[model samples]
Every structure is written in structure tokens, then in C-alpha cells.
Target: MFNIYKEMWDRRKMIHALSLQEIKKEYAGTVLGSVWGLVNPLMRIAVYWFVFSIGTRADNPVGGAPYAAWLAIGMVAWFLLNDAFRLSQKAFRSKRSIIKNTPFPIAILPAVQITFSFYTHLILLVVILIAMAFALQTVSVYWLQILYYDFAALMLLLGLGSVTAPLVAISKDFGRFLDTVLIFLFWMTPILWPVENAGPLENVVKLNPFHYIVQGYRDSIFYHSGFWEHPLYTLYFWALVLVLFILGNYLYKRMKPIFLDIM
Candidate 1:
């Protein structure tokens, strides 16, 4: 494990280059180029704003925060976490040739996806900051909250990717199934609505760990709350994330050698 991690560390340039290449390739043929990063999330924010504000009333208003601004802050952070988690698992399947032709650090593929997730989230984060200044009528001094949630989200993604990337190599069905499940989870999560306001279905919302995660981001940036505010839940989240990583690493080690053949 130590050796694999060290080799990955030594190939920093290659990982950086691959991540850049993936970013360029991402919006290559599009008219807006890299601006798609800003555009897509902006569109999502607008949709959720219209839905919650107009379609249904979303409560827990970020401690006297504007709904638009609240949604922006919470959703942007949630987008980063979910996108990083969902897409990083695609590393092996997306780069079939890179894996088959070269004996490079397969680990970097997920990291590349994670880097792209960060880049896109940064654009949305900037927009949220600007919106917070204008709509919320206050600047956030919750830099530490943002950092805490970002760190927690990264752990979730890193651990998930480490496990899922290898699973994808061994089982393509895992990817397809994950995509299907994410659709269900998007609704099950409180992105378009608040889990706390689930009425009679509140217990159902409580069962999902993701609802708490979304709440974590929303609380951190939108409501200006700190990680320690909900000590028990926060500890639970990290513990679950750690278990995921441990399982992921074991799976990766077991499956990586046989990945190319299955691919």
C-alpha cells in the first residue's frame, strides 16, 4: 500500500498532465469551450431555484438567508461533492487505452477526475460567493466551514473512487448501476428540497447518509454553521467514509491486475 502510494506521489507531473488533458478534452468540440463549466452548474442552480422557490417551498432558509443565495451556496458545494464522487469512479472505464497500453499509475485516473471536479466546483463557488455578497447581504467569514466540508467531501470521493475505480475495471455493470442509483439518490437527497422538511417522510430522508452530507455543505456555507455543531453526525460521517476507503483499497488491490483482461 505504501509503495503504491509513493509511486503515485512520484508521478505527480504525469497525473497533473493527464488531468489537464482530460479538462481540455472535456469541452473540446463545444462552442463555449471551458465555459461549459460555468454554464452547466448555473443552469442547474437556476432550475433548482425555480423549483424550490416556485414549484415547492423549501424551508430551513440558511438562517435568514435568501433562498436563491442559500441554494447557490448549498448546491454548489453539493455539486462538487456528488460530481467528484460519481465521476471519479469512471477513471478506468473512460481511459481504456491509457490503462491497456501503458503501465502507468492507474491511481491517477481517479485523481484526475477529482481535480476536474475541483476546477468546476471552483467556478460555481465563485458565483456563489458573489451571489452571497449581493443576495445574502453579508460576506461569509465561514472559511473554516467551507474548508471542513470540502475536506470531508474529498475524503468521501477519494475513498469512493479508490474502491469503485477498481470495481469498474472488474465489473462494467457497476458503473451503469451506479449511474442509475445516482438518479434515485439525487431525488432522495435534499438538493431540490430539504430533508428536514420531508413531512411524514422525514424518517425516510434520515436513513440516507447523503442527506446529512448535503446538509453539512448547506450548513457550512449557507447557514454559516461549523462542523462541531453536530458532533455525533459528523463523527458518523467520517467513520463511514473511512470504512468505504478501506474496502475500496482492498478491492483495488485484488482487481487491478485482472482489470486489463476484463477491459
Candidate 2:
């Protein structure tokens, strides 16, 4: 695992270049271009706000926080985590040519894709922060906890991507399977609803590592609480992350060599 990370560091320049190119290509030929990265999330938030707040009148204060504020925080975390996994499915397929022709670390493919999505997430994070400030009247120091949560999200992304990218490379059906899995997870997660409102099912939702992240974001902006406030959740999240990291590294080490032949 250390050696794989060392190789990624040794080829850091390649990762940066590829990540930047991917970001540019994502918005290429569009009128808004990179601005869409910011716009898309805002649009989604607006639509959801309208549907739940105005259309259905389901917008209610969650844990004493404004519905919009809670929704934005959850959506910001969800968008980043979702994009990390979704784009990771393409890590090998999208860069098969570079993998076949280049000699750099193939592990960097998922890193590049995740980093590209992180850029978009950063934009949305700023938008969320600004909106929170207006809605809450103040942004507390706890908001900085978002950095910790974002790091957790990155580790989870890299770890899961390490496993899934190789599996998807080997079998296209695996990618579809992952998509279905993510869809189920999305609904199960408390992005659009309150975990407290989940009642008896709250324990089931708590089993999801993503709930830690989503709730952590809300804690940072809306709840004004630090991650350490919930020691049990922190422990559970890190344990899951560590397991995924080990499993992903093992899979990548064994499967990376076969990627070319499969491609």
C-alpha cells in the first residue's frame, strides 16, 4: 500500500495533468463551461427546495435548522461522494489508451478522476458555505470540520475506487451493479430527510458510512458541532474506511497487472 502511494507521488505530475485535462474535457464546448460545475449543484438544490419546500410543503425545520440550510449541507456532501464513486467506475475504461501506452502508475487513474470531481465539489462547498452564512446569520468555527469530513470522503473514494475500478475494468456488468448499489444507498442516506425522523430505521441508516459524512457536514454548518462530539460514529466511519482501504489496495495490486489484457 505504501509502495502504491509512493508510485502515485513519484508520478504526481502525470496525475495533476490528467486530472486537469479531465476537468476541462468535462465542460468542453459548453457555453458556461466550468461554471456549470457550480451551477449544476445550485440548480439541483433549487429544484429540490422547490419540490419539497414549495410544491409539497414538506420543508420543515430539521434539528432546529432551516430546511434549505440542512438540505444544502446534505446535498453538498452527497454530490461530492456520489461523483467520486460514479466517476471512479470510468477510471480504467476512460483511460485505457493511456494505460496501454504509458508506463506511469495505473493507480493514479482513480486518483485523477476523484481529484477532478473534487474540484467541482470545492466550488459547491463554497456555495453551500455562503448560503449557510446567509441563512444562519453566522458561520461558526465548527464549519472548518468540513475539511475533516472532506478528507474522510476522499479516503473512502480512493479506497472504494481502487477495488471497483479494477472490477469494472474486468467486467462491464460490475459497473452497472455498482450504479444500482449507489442508487439504493442514495435513498437510504439522509440527504433529503432527517435521520432523527428516520425513527426505528435510524440504526440501519447509521450503519452507512455515508451518514457520518452527511451528518458531519450538517454538524459543521448547521449544527455547529465538531466530529469528536460523536465518538462512536467517528470510530465506525474510520474503521470502515480502513477496511475499504486495505481491501482496495489488495485488489488493485492483484488486478492492476491484468487490466491491460482485459482492456
Candidates' lDDT values, in order? 0.75, 0.86
Locate the minimum summed-lDDT window of 10 residues in model 1: 1-10
How well does model 1 score by local distance difference test? 0.75
Q: Judged by TM-score, which candidate is best?
A: 2
Model 2 regions more than 4 Å off: none
lDDT of 1 at 161: 84
Q: Per-residue lDDT tens digits of candidate 1, residues 1-263?
A: 43434555687677678767878988999999988988888898889887777877654454565667666766786788678878888888888997889876777778778877887787777776776667656666675567666777777777778878888777889898888877888777776656656899996676666666667766755666777887777778888887886787777777777887788
Q: How big is the positional error of residue 70 in model 2, measured in Å on the Cα after superposition? A: 0.7
Task: Please report how far candidate 1 places residue 15 from its true position, in Å.
Answer: 2.6
